[model samples]
Target: MYQYDNYDQAMVDARVAEFRDQVARRLEGKLTEEQFRPLRLMNGLYLQLHAYMLRVAVPYGTLSGKQMRMLGHIARKYDRGYGHFTTRQNIQYNWIKLSDAPDILADLASVEMHAIQTSGNCIRNISSDQYAGVAADEVADPRPWAELLRQWSSFHPEFSYLPRKFKIAVIASAQDRAAMRLHDIGLELVKKDGVIGARVFVGGGMGRTPIVAPEINAFITEDEIISYVEACLRVYNRYGRRDNKYKARIKILVHELGVEEYRRQVAEEFAHMKALGLNPPREELARIAAHFATPAYESGLSDDLDRSDPDFALWVDRNVTAHKQPGYAIANISLKPIGGIPGDASADQIELMADLAERYSLDELRVTHAQNIVLPYVKKADLYALWKELEANGLGEPNLDLVTDIIACPGLDYCSLANARSIPVAQKIASRFASNGRDAEIGELKLKISGCINACGHHHAGHIGILGVDRKGTENYQLLLGGSGAEDCSLGTITGPGFDENGIVDAVEKATDLYLRERTEGERFLDTYRRLGMAPFKEAIYG
Candidate 1:
C-alpha cells in the first residue's frame, strides 16, 4: 500500500544497475563463485541443490495488487511457473538462473520491491501482524513502526555484517500472529495509562537452539523505540560470537550472558545512543505513518454474511476473522489445499489473487507467516462471490490451522544444506490426515517439518515438530512435541530417537490417536499436549 517516493525509486534503480554489472562480471568469469557468493547473497540470491534461489522481500508482509501482479510476472517469466511463499512472509524462486538475477530485481524494483536484506547478515525484512490495521483487538497498527525500522536498517553501514542474520517482528494484538517472541527482536505495541509504548523482547530465535525471547523492557515510549532497538543491536553486534556460526545468533549471547546481564548491557547502550541522538526524527515517523492511513469505507453496509450455502458457511467459519471495520471481514486464502504443497502458488494463482484483491479487498493484501494471504478489508456481502472465485482458482481451502495445513521447508528437494527431504514427509503427513472429519475431530494442530536443524520450517514452533536428519546415510526423522508459535511461545522438546520416514508418519498418527483418546472436552492438540506434557505422547509414539 505504501508507494515509493522519488528517493526510494532512485535508490532501488541504482542498486539494480550495480547488481547488473556484478552479475555480468560473474558470468564473464571476472569473478569466481567464491568471489560472488557474498555479493549474490547480499542481493538475496542463493545457490541451492538444483539451481539458484532468489528470495524477494515482502516488507512487513504488505503488498498492493500491482506488486502482487509483478511477483506473478516474475514467477512466470524468470523462474518456474510457481513460487514458494516462506514462513518469513517472503517468496522464494527455487529455480533461478544467475544471469536473470539482475533482471528479476529490476522487475521487482519497478513495483517498489527488492530482495535486499532478505538473506544477508544485516537486518532482514521487518515482519508484523498480517492483520495489523484491521484486527478488532489491535492497540495500534504496527506497520508504521515496522516501516520506519525498515527504512532505518536498510544498508546501515554499522550493521551491514553482524555475527549472524537478524530478524525483527512487531505485533499490536494480544495474539502473536507474527511469532513475535521467536524473532531476534520483538516489539509488542502496548498502551498503559492512555500512553502508547513498546514492550521489547530480545534474543529470541529458532535453529539448533530455540529460545523464546525474554522481555528486555516492559515499556519504552514509542518515540524512543528506534533508539532502544539500535542499542540492542549494538550490544549483540559488539559481543555476539564470531568464531562459530552455530553460536553466533543473539540468542546464544543472551543465553551465555543471562537475561539480566543482557538487559543491563542494552540499557547502557541505550543511554549512550540516546546521548548521541540516535532516535529517529518525529517528522520522519509522521511521514511514514501518513502512507498507512485508513481507507475510506462505505456507510450503512450490512455486517451479515449470506452463509445459507453450507460450503460458504464452512469457509467463513474456518478462514475469516472479525474486522474492526463495520461490514468488513479479514479473509484468509489458504495455500495449503488438502495434500497440495503448503505454500506453493502458481503464477496464474498469484495473478488471480491480485485481481481479486484489486476488485474486492481495497487493492491490498497481506501475507501471513503461516504461508497464507489475507484480504484484510473485504466486505461481508461480497464473501460468497470472492469464495467462488478463489475456489475456482484453487486458492480457496477452508483448512486454516488444521492438521492438513502443514508448514514445511524446501528441505533436500531444493536446499543443499538439507540432510533429508521434507516436502514428501509433509505431503505424506497431510495425506494421512486428509479426512475433514478427522481434522475437525483433532482440532487446531500445527505440524511443521524441516529438512535439517536450520529450522526454516519453524519446526521448533509447531505443535508437532518434525526434523529430518541423515542417520548412517539413511533419511531419518525426529519428532518434537508441545511447541507453539503464538503469544505464549514455547520451544518443543525432542522425543527420544529418530524414526524412518514411514515410521515418523505412523508415529504422528499414533500421537494424534493418543490425543483423541485422552483429550478432555474442547481440548486442542496443543492444549492436550501442554496439559499432559510429553510423557504420554512420547510413550504413545515410541511404545
Candidate 2:
C-alpha cells in the first residue's frame, strides 16, 4: 500500500517512454535480437519456448485493489485471459507478444507497478511475509524495510550487474513464512530492551546447490541495516565468481569462503561503508515507514465464526488464520483448486478477487510465495458471505497447506530451460490425493515440483520434492524427502532413483502410505521424517 510519490511516478513514466522507443527500434530492425536481449531482460521480458513472457513485480507481495484490477485488465487485454502468480509473489504473462510489450508496461506504469528487476542480475523484487502488518507474532512490519531496500537497490549503479541474480526476504514473525533462510539475504526483525533490530542471514539459496543461510550478525540496529546490506552486497559483487555462471550466486561464494571468512569480510566492508556514510539517514527510514501505517480497524466485531455449516467450518479451519486485530482473521484464497493449475488466475477471477478485497479486506491484498492470495483483514462476521462469493467464482478451495495444495513451476510447458513437464505431474499428484477426508487425515504436507534443477518450484524446501529430468529423451522425476523452508530450514535428500511420471505419482502415494503407518500422534510428515530419517521412507519409495 505504499503510494508512488511524484518522483516515483515520473521515473516509471520515463522508463515506459524509453521502453517504447526500444521496442520500436527492435521492431524496425534497428536492433537485432542479440542486441535487445539484455535490454528486454532488464525490463522483465523473456523469450520462452512458445512466446515472450513478462514478469511484473509485486513489491513485498502487497497490492491495492486498484493494482489488482489493473493486473486483471492486463491479463484480459494483452495476453491470454489468465496470469500465473509465481513462487516469488510476482505475476507472469506467458503468451506475450513483443509488439505489445510496451503497451503492457505502460498499463502497468499507469498503476505505479512495473517489471523492473523482476528479472536480470540486479536485485530482484524484495519479498516478505504476506501476513506482515497483521500477523499476531510480528515484532514489527517487515514491509517498510523491504520497501526501503527496494528503493535503495533499484537501478543501483554499483549493483546493476552482479555475478548472478540476488534476492532478499524480510520476516518479522517467528514463523518463517517468507522462506527467509532460502534467500540470498534474509533479515529477521528482533527486539531487545524494547528496541527493534535486525538479525542478518547471508548466502542462502536454492538451485542445483541448495543451502540454508547462516546467521551473519546476531543484531544490527535498525538505523544501520542499509549499511550492513550494502556491505554484504559489495563483498559479493567484488569477489563472487565470474568465471562460471553456474557457480555465481552468493551462496557459492559463501560456501567457498567459509562462513567465518565471509562474516569477517562482511564486517570489514560494513566498517568501510559506515565510514563512507552510505547508510540512509534515520529520518528517511522514518519517512518510508509512514507509508505503511496500520489500517483503522473497526472495534467490537465478532471473533466467532458461524460454523453451523460444515463446509463453511471446514473452509474456515483450513483457510483462515488468526489476525493481530480483534474480531478479524486472515483468509487465504487458494489458487490450487483440486486439479487446476497451481498458481494461475483467470481475468474474471482476478477481477472478482479485487472487488472482494475492496469490499471486505480493507482494500488490500497480499500474494503469498506459495501462490495464493491473502485477504489480510477480513471481519469474522462476514466470513460466510465472502466464502460464498469466492466459491461461486471458482476462487475458493479450502486446502491451505494440505497434501493436495502443491507448489509447482511453469516447467516444460512454458519454460525453454525446462527438461520435463511439471504441471501435468503436479496435476496428477493432486488428483491422486484429492480425497478430502484422506487429505485432512494426512495433515499438513508441503509437496513441490520443479521442471529442472533451477528449483523454481522450490523443490528443495518441500516435505515431498519432485524434480523433473530428461533421461534418454524421456521425462523422469527424482524424489526427495525431509526438506523444509521454515525457521527450521533444510534441503531435501534424494531417494534412490528417478521415476517416470506415473511411477513418481505412485511413488509419492506409497511414501505417504508409509508415513501414515509410521507416524505417531500429532506428528506431521516433516516431523515424522525427521524422527524416522530416510531409511523407512526410502525403502517404501524404492522397494
Candidate 3:
C-alpha cells in the first residue's frame, strides 16, 4: 500500500478542515442545501433518499489490515453495523449523520484514506486488477501507474470539473479483471521488445448509453502514459457536451464523433501535452513503484494443499486461484452469502477479514470488482485453516462466478434515483438459487442487477442481467443476456418485455434451464449463449 507522505497528509487534512467548515455552515443555516450540494459532493457526501451516504476511496483496492480494521470501526461506531463494497472496489455507508461527517473524514484521514473525488463529476477513484501483483499473467503491477495517475489527477485544477464524472482503470493482464474497457480511460501495460508501454482505450462506460471503448493509442512508451491520459481527458473536457447532463460522459462524446476523429483530436492534444513536458520524470514513477514492491516469500515451500475435507476442497476449487509465486494462492472471500445482500460485510466479518489478512495474507488484502475480498498471498499449506475460520464466520461461500455470486446496487431501498427496489430482487434470486444444485452446474455466470438505467450494478456487463424499472407506477424488471465486462467486452441485450419482480427471477431460472439442457460439453453459460443467440433464451423466458 502507498503510505501517505506529509504532502498527502497535508492535502487530506486541509480538505477535512475545509469540509468541516462547509458542513458546519450547512447545519447552522449559513449555507442552504442548494449552496452546499457541490461542496458536500466534492467531499464524497450524498443526501440519499433516506439519509446521507458516505463513499470512501480505497485506491486501487489495496488495504492494510489496520486500514480494513478502521473500516470495521467506522461501521460499528458511525452508521449501520455493515458497509457495502461497491463494484468500483470502494465502500459505502448508507446511514450517516450530518453532524458526524467531519469526524468521520478525520478518522479516515488518520488511516491514509478519504472520501475525496468519490461523488463529484471528476476523475473518481482509480481502479485496477485485484490480483495485480500476484496474478500469474501480469505484465507488471498496475498499481504504481495507478498511484501515479491518482497523484496526477487529485484536485487537478484543469480537470477539477469535467463535463461529467470520469473513471479510469489500469490492468497489466490480458484478462480484463478490472473491467478495463468499461472505463472512461483504460490503460493496459504491455511490453514491446522487452520495454513496457501502455495500450490505451478511450470512451468506455455503462449508463443509458453503454459502450466498449475503442483503442485510441496502440502503444505509448512507459514514460508517456500520464501525458497520453491527460491528452485524452483534455480532448473530452474541451468538446464533451455540457448542455445535457445525460449525454455528458466522454463515451457519448466519442460516439458522436467517430473513433477516427476522436483519435485524431487526442493525437493533436498529445503533441501539445508532450511539448509541455506533462509526463512526470521517470524517477517519480520509480519512487511510486517502490511502494508496491513484492513481499518476501519463503523459498522451497510446498505447493500442495491438503484437501481432505470435501467441503473445504470444494471451497479451494471454487474460490482459490493460482498466484505468481510458488506455494501461494489468491483466496477470494465471498461477501455475497446466499440470501444476504451482495457486497456487504458486517463489522465483525470485516474485522475477521482484517485479522485473516494480517495472520495469513502478508498483512494486505484487496477488494475485487465483483464485490469480494482477496487474500492475495495465502499459503497453500494453510488453506484449510483459513477456510475453517472463514466458514465459521459468514465469509466462506464457495460460490465464485457462479449464479449465487450476484452483483447488485442499492436500489429504491437506498438510492433516490432508483425506480424500483433492487435489494429484494437480488435477495429473492439469491435465495431461490442458494440450495439448488443447478447454480454450480451453471458455472461462471455473471448476474448483475441495477435499480435504474444508471447501471450502478453493472447490469450491462452481466451474462444474465436484471434491470428494475417503473412501469405505470409499478415496479417491473427487464431481463438481459450475453453481456460481459471481460477482455471480450460486450453489452447485454434485452430479452423482449419486462416482468414483475418475482417473474424476473423465474425468467432467469428458465434461461439457465435452457442452457443446461442445450449446452454442449465444456461450454459455460456465456459461451452457450453466444453460440445459440438470444432467440432461444428469449423464447424460453417469455413463453
Candidate 4:
C-alpha cells in the first residue's frame, strides 16, 4: 500500500528509458551477449534455458490491486500468459522477448513498481512478514523498516557490487514466516522496556553451503538499525571472497572469521558509520511509516461465520489466520493446485486475485515466501463468498502447510543453473500424495524442491526436501529430512542415496509414513522428525 512519490516515479521512469536504449542497442548488434549480460541482469532480465526471463520485484511482498493488475497485464501481453511467483516474494516471466522488456518495465513503473535490485550483486528485494501489519502478535509492522532499507540500498555506491548476491528479511512476529534466519541479514523487531529494537542476525544463507545466520547484535535500537546493517555489510564487502563464487556469500566469510571476530569488526564499522550520520533523520522514518497506515475498520462488526458448508469451513480452518483486527481474517490463496505447478498463476488468476484484493482486502495483496498470495484483511463475514469465488477460479485449496502444498524452483525447464527438472518432480509428488487422500492425513508438512544445490527452492529448509541432481547424466532426486524454516529453523540432512523420479516420490511418502506411524499426538511432520531424529526416517526411506 506504499504509493510512489514524484521522486520514486522519476527514478523508475528514468530506468525504463535507459533500459530501452540498452535493449535497442543489443538488438541492433551493437552489444554482444557478454556485453549485455550485466546490464540486463541489473534490470532483472535473465537468459533462461528456453527464453529470456524477467523478474519483477514485489518489495516485502506488498502491492496494491492496481500494481497486481499491472503484473497480470505484463504476463498477458509481454510474456506467456502466466507468471511464476518466486520464494523471494517476486514474480518471474519465463518466456520473455528481449525487445519487450522495456515495455514491460514501463508498464510496471506506471503502477509504482520496478524490477530494480531484483537481481545482480546489489541487495535484492527487502522482504518482510507477509502478515506484517495484520498479525496479532507482532510488535510492529515490518514494512516501514523494509522500505527504509530498500531506499538506502537501492544504489548505494559502496555496495553496488558485493562478493555475492545479498538478501535481507525482516520480521516483527515471533514466528519466522519470512525465513528470517536464512537471509544474509535477518532482523527481528522485538519490544524490550517498552521500546521496539531489532535483534540482528547476519551471514545466513542456503546454497551449496547452507548456514544459519549467527546473532551479531542481541539488540540494536530501532533508530540505529540502518546504521547497524550498513556496518555489517561493510565488513562482509571488505573481506568476503570475490574470486570463488562458491565461497563468496557472507555466510562463508562469517564462518571463516568466526562469530566473535565478525562481531568485533562490525562494531568497529558501526562506530565509524554512526559518526558519519548515515541514518536518515527520525522524520524520514515517520514519513515512510505514514504511507503504511492501517485502513479504517467498521465498528461493532459481528465475528460470526457460517460453518454449514463443510468445504468452506475446511478452507477457513486451513487457509486462514487470525487478524489483529476483530471480525477480520488473513486469507491465504494457495498456488499449489494438485498436479499443477507450485507458483505459476495464469494471467486470468492474477487478475482475479487483484479483484479480490480490491474488493475484500482493503485494496492490498501480499505474496508469501512460500509462493502463495495472501489477502491480509478479509472480513470474517465474507469468508464463504470469497472461498466460493476462489474455488470457482481454482484458487481455493485447503492445503496450507500440508503435504500437497509444495515449494519448488524453476528447474531445468527454465533455469540454466538447474541440473534436473523440478516441476515434474513437484507435480508427481503432489499427485502421489493427493490421489489416495494421504495429503489430508499427513498434516503440516513443509515440502520443498530444488533442481540443484544453489538451493533456490530452499530444499534445505523444508520438513521434507527433495533435491534434483545429475547422477551419471540421469536426473536423480535426493530426499532430505528434519528441515524447517519456522521459528525453530534448522537445515535438513540428506538421506542415504539418490532415487529416480518416481522412486523419489515413493521415498518421500515412505518418510512421511514413518512420521505418521511414529508421531505422538498433535505432532506435525517437522515435530515428529525432530523428536525421533533421522534414524527412523532414513531407515523408512532407504528400506
Computed on alpha carbons, the lDDT of every model, listed in order, comes to 0.92, 0.93, 0.94, 0.93
lDDT accuracy of residue 335 in candidate 2: 97
lDDT of 3 by residue, 245-347 (tens): 9999999999999999999999999999888887899999999999999989988989987777999999999999999899899999999898899999999
> What's the lDDT for candidate 2?
0.93
Which residue pairs in candidate 2 have backbone atoms (N, alpha carbon, C) closer than 3 angstroms, thus clashing? none
Task: Kindly provide the TM-score of model 3 when superposed on the true structure, using C-alpha atoms.
Answer: 0.99
Once model 4 is optimally superposed onto the true structure by TM-score, how far is the C-alpha of residue 530 displaced, in angstroms? 1.4
What TM value does model 4 have? 0.99
Q: Model 4 — which ten-residue stretch has the worst lDDT? A: 534-543
Off by over 4 Å in 4: none
Ranking by lDDT: 3, 2, 4, 1
* RMSD in Å for model 2: 0.8
Q: Is candidate 2 or candidate 4 better by lDDT?
A: 2
In TM-score terms, candidate 1 sits at 0.99
TM-score for all models, in order of appearance? 0.99, 0.99, 0.99, 0.99
Better of 1 and 2 by lDDT: 2
Candidate 4: residue pairs that collide? none
